[model samples]
Target chain A: MVKTVASVGLPVDEVLEIKKNRILPEGESDGKKKRISIVTGIHGDELEGQYVCFELIRRIEEHKELLKGIVDVYPAMNPLGIDSITRGIPAFDLDMNRLFPGNKDGDMTEFLASGMIADVDGSDVCIDIHASNIFLTEIPQIRINELHKEKLIPLAKELNVDFIWVHGANTVLESTFAHSLNSRNVPTLVVEMGVGMRITKEYCNQLVDGILHLMETMEIWAGETIEPRKPIISEDADDVTYLNAPTAGVFVPRVKHWEHLKKSDEIGWIIDPLHGKILEKILSPVDGILFTIREYPIVDHGSLIGRLLREEARKE
Target chain B: MEKKIIYEISSLYRDNFRVTGFEFGEGEKSVCIVGNLRGNEVQQIYTCSQLVQKFKVLEKEGKIRKGHKVLIIPSMNPYSMNSKERFWPTDKTDINRMFPGYDLGETTQRIAAGIFEVIKDYKYGMQFASFYMPGKFMPHVRMMQTGFENVEMAKEFGMPYVVLRKIRPYDTTTLNYNWQIWETNAFSIYTTSTTEIDKESAKEAIRGILRFLAKQQIIEYTTHEGYKSSVVTDSEMISVRTKSAGIFDSKVKAGEEIAKGQILAQIIDPLEGEVKENLISPVDGIVFFGHNDPLTYANTAVFKIISGGI
Candidate 1:
């Protein structure tokens, strides 16, 4: 089934619409069943989640016998932002993620946010997928506000992901869709991977499998008995260390992501673009495994080009 | 005046990003002024730059009293300012929201950490802050209630209003709230506009800061006796919301006195040019904030009035 989330009349005699795809199990008996919502592309620039949405729908269509619960997928909530490849909603020029639990009678962005929230309200488990910003690559991971770790960690571990980072002090956590949903007692896992405006097929497939496994574990689908994939998770923000640019130049990276390096290992260099001279040689500070590295090279001073997960940084 | 680079941020193509602070005097850290943590904060940055120009002359003329240090940073997010982007261009994050940041954290976090490391120990921290909502405000001094809040010191600014807001959970990451938590008498000065510079308001803001400094005995300049600021808690403000969405034609400006049931604005249908609804004042008071945006949303706050039975 398909539904229009919201519609706005455009000035040029056209209409802008946000749509959602809903998939239900066949021939229901008694009306007691679970519903899981998989939302993605709230950020118009992050498109990896769209692929996961497609894969989830495709797999469900192929294996109808294994499906017993309801699946709702919001592929692109900000249709105009996604269409224009912009980071925020068009016309309003606002971040939809920051306007969650929105006022129904508020402005355009808030109206859209309210509709999106209402569409997913009362779901048992909600999943928000995202791709990292355009300038970097990321391993598939789940992110939660540090405050929600005690209640959310076990739920996050159910999904197939490489890392789980508990971040601190972002006002977005109080206003974002996942956080608002969690506050309403609905558990949500925010997944991130790949690069913005692009799709990582492997990451999408991995998360799709994880989602299916979680469904089985939740007894929504009784066809297959599945074991939860234990992922490398960190409960504190300090488990990952960021390496930033040292000078203004074209950065040339020497090591790939997910590679291990010793302290002082040469990871990259900043070249003075005009003079073709070496400006600064970037090196690793501690013995750690690099999980995030800069894919797009043009950076400013203090720009994050790499992130390292320390070997033994997590608190036991 | 000595310009010192407090923190260095590495860039790939442009020059190394640096947060530079202009030092006026050389003893104890007395006051630190910051502006433009995000782009679109033109009024804040403009006001601070004017103060910097004024402070330079004051320092040379021996107006800055001895044994007191003053620092003014006109901007902390020059990259975003250059592009007219409100947040960090690459990551789309807000630098203002990352206060007392972690050195090993993300890019914005590191920037906040670096800037906070230099200014956190000051006796007073003042920021020319823009409102989260795009609107016009009656020039005021605002302080968060952090248990260490000093409302009396805030009144020294002599702005028309000294607003006290109990901090919300979201405010924990903002610079104003963190400064108070760190024991600095922190206050945020809100001017009239965000994107456009109102020279009149800018002058008024400059005078207010000068008045505060003179009151604190940090400077020797004599300024006009501005308003004996009225302390208003956030809860005391009465908000007027729009009943319909359209082009908003405001009949009242900020700081204007109004009686109950007075017409404040009219929402007009943009296409047909017909009046949709009239925004009337619900309380007899002074306008604390008048929404400056030409277009308004239905049920959105357009006017806030201080309901003092004056």
Candidate 2:
């Protein structure tokens, strides 16, 4: 079922609208089924989630009996931003994610945020999907906040991602949609994959499977659970060490995402573009996993170009 | 005797960013001054860069006291500054708001983490801060209301007003609040402008910072006596706002004392040539902040006055 949940525009002019795709069980059950929400395109530039949303709906369409509960998919939150290829809301230039649980009486952005929170409030679990920004390409990862680690880990591990990063409390803003929803007792998972403005077909399909597996874990769906392909993990954000450029120059990357690294291994190099001299050789500080590398060559002093996650042992 | 590369950041683009700081009297980390963290903060960058130039000469003259070191990072977020942007270029995030940051987080968070790793150990920190609003403020020293706040220490800088702010929930992530939490006496010095260089206010700011270092016995240089700052709470100030939106005409400037009934500004209708509203000073005190934007919005704060007896 599709419904125009929120809209804005004059009666005579073009009215902007947002539609929610609700997939319900095939037949009326004895009891109310649990609801799971899948959100994507909060950042209008991240296109990978849109494709995943499409695939999820397609699968549900094909096998209606496999779905035991309702699936609410907000395929694109900022349609105007997506239309313009901008990261911020088209008219206000505000980041919609930062204004979650917004005031209905406030400005247009806040009203929209408030409406969105209301739309997904009672879901048993919520997923905020995103693609990495323009400067970097990332391995598929599920990032869960540390405060909800124990409550979220089992489900996060079931997400079939390459890595799971549990962020400290301060890492994610309280105003963010994930935090707001999670704080309200709705378990939330943030999935980041591929790159901004473009959809990685491989990552999209992989994440769709993870989402399905999560639904199965919650007993909301009867489907084959997909195991993680690469399950390297970090206990929390503290387990990550950052290597910054000590000065400005062109950065030449020496490593790729998901690569294992030894202590003092050269991760990248900073070079003076005009003089063509080697200014600094950046190195990994610990024996860990290199999960991120700056894709852009130009860096300012103190810009973080690389990050390594200190590995943690898995619980049997 | 010369500049040193304190930190470097390599990016995907054609150029690299460097945080260049001048080092003097290498001993204990006595003080560290940070310049613009935002791109549009040209005045803050200019003030810190001038201090760097001055300190280079001071280091040569042996005026930096023994067993003390001073570091001045003139510019940190130059990528945004190069393009005159107000935030990080790629993500449009504010670096100042990500203080004591997560090393594994986004770009701004990582940048803040790198600097905090270095400067958190310093005895004192000074940032040439700009206001969130586009306006001119009376040169002052601002400190957060962390348990470590020292209004007396702030007065040493000799700015006109020493304002202490209660830590808001959102302020916990700012650099000033984090520095205090880390045991550094962090003070934010706001000059008159953000993008435009106010040379007079900039000179006063540089002098005030040096005066602070001198007061701490970190340096032996002689300087003029600065303001015996009136320590004010953030709540004491009254904001004078415009009732109508239009082209603004101000009758008073920043730092000028005003009476309760005096006219502060007039909002003129942009399309129709007529006075829409006349804003009056409601408090008998000095103008602590003045709106510099040419236009005014209805119900917008145009000036912040230090309301009290003269």
Candidate 3:
């Protein structure tokens, strides 16, 4: 069965509007069990998460016999953003991700966000899928709150990702979508992968599998036994290194993404295109994995070249 | 002599209030030229004042003859004009949105009604405007009603651009919108201004209004230069938005010719501090309006480039 959540303005006078597409279980006798909900495409430009949601829905539909608890999938929470092909809905210029637990009577985006929060209030768990913001390439990862360590950390491991980043409640504030859900005592996790404006099939597949693993663990799916995931985990408030360009020039990188590096190793070089002068050589500050790298290379003063998760440098 | 007055409401109360107007002639083709309902548009006031003063001089010199008692209300939002705001005191509702007036509505609605009541009947109406929206727009005449005569008058204005715009029928409070309800011919002349009006655009708008009045025979004036085009539509106005959110740095100017695929602007990453995306013109055209300021978010209209026509 399908259900429609009428937001502030009665869900846009259309029969097949996005908000109207809600999937309920086939023969669910009980509604007291905690339910896991998944959402993607809060930002229009981030398309990979939407693809992941589609893939998961198809897989779930194929094996309906395994379904038990209710799982709501919102593929595109921000329809206006998708229509305009923009990240933020143009009417109010507010980011939906940041407007969670929003004012229902405020501006347009805020109202929508608040309405979504209200709709998902009693859910057992929620997962928000997102892509990088049109700048950096990212490895598949899951973010959990440090405060909800016992609840989210176990689920993070079950996600079967390369990295598990435990984000402290204080560090991310209540501005993010994950924070809004977590604040309501909901076990929320933010799964991020792929670069902004681009997608990787492998990364999307990983995210889908991880979500399936979580579902089976909750006994929502009575399917075959799934393999547990071994993830490289880090504390929320761990030491991190910011790699910045020392000189103003065109940056050309030699080190590839996810490459294990040593201290003082050459990561990239900045060169003046006109005179062929090598202005700066980017070197790794600590021994760790290159977690992320800047894709676009026109560098100015104090531009971040890459971010290295310094595993060797421990806190004093 | 039915006299005109500027009620400097600043003296009457703490908040500012004033009435702007002009009156001349008496006859069959009565007209009123009101302008700049939005604030941050001082150019319309200047042009209307100049035109009314011209009519006043002709009437005083005894050279005036025939057609229309003209009323020109130059700048309605005197407080906004003074403070460089686009809307009313606190509501920030566009005065244009508050049409046909409301007795119990907001400040903007009340003012809109008062202004409408003053000039409901006129044979032909024209409203002068300058860009208060954060970009440079070309000098053009916009009208709602259909008919070759309205287009002809717009052409007669001799502006470089003319647009036969569809003023949404629901918006009946605007001067042009109201004039249409009263069965009067109306057009809006738009050019450039927000904090400051561009001089060349201002001159072209004034010249267009003069040419329009001349053809109406309200005052005998002549112009040898031909109009750039007969008219334009809302479809012709192509608005270009940014693809990414960041600090915007522009590379082109309004009215400058641009090639297809040429870089128009670049969005710099606030976190990384580099040019992340370079916005380019998808079609060959002339830049109509580009944001002069650098700080802008993604998907916001950075420029409006128009193509075709000489």
Best by lDDT: 1
Candidate 3 lDDT tens digits, A189-244: 88878876777888888888888888888877777645755777778354557676
- For candidate 1, the docking band is acceptable
What i-RMS does each candidate reach, in Å? 3.9, 7.4, 22.9
Ranking by lDDT: 1, 2, 3
Candidate 2 regions exceeding 4 Å error are A1-34, A55-72, A75-119, A157-163, A167-175, A209-316, B1-30, B49-71, B77-80, B83-122, B168-175, B210-310
Evaluate candidate 2 by giving its C-alpha RMSD to the native, one decimal: 6.5
DockQ for each model? 0.27, 0.11, 0.01
For model 2 the local lDDT of residue A265 reads 86
What Cα-based lDDT does every candidate model obtain?
0.84, 0.81, 0.69
Best by DockQ: 1
lDDT by residue (tens digit), candidate 3, B218-298: 766667565656455766767676655667788988878888899999888766778878988988888877887666644
Worst 10 residues of 1 chain B by lDDT: B9-18
**Which stretches in model 1 have alpha-carbon errors above 4 Å?**
A4-19, A28-30, A88-95, A98-119, A144-157, A165-172, A222-230, A236-239, A260-266, A284-288, A311-316, B7-12, B15-18, B308-310
- What clash count does candidate 2 reach? 24
Model 2 TM-score, 2 decimals: 0.70
lDDT for B199 (candidate 3): 69
Q: Which residue segments of model 3 deviate by more than 4 Å? A: A1-316, B1-3, B6-12, B56-64, B103-106, B130-132, B145-149, B167-172, B270-273
TM-score of chain B of each: 0.97, 0.97, 0.85
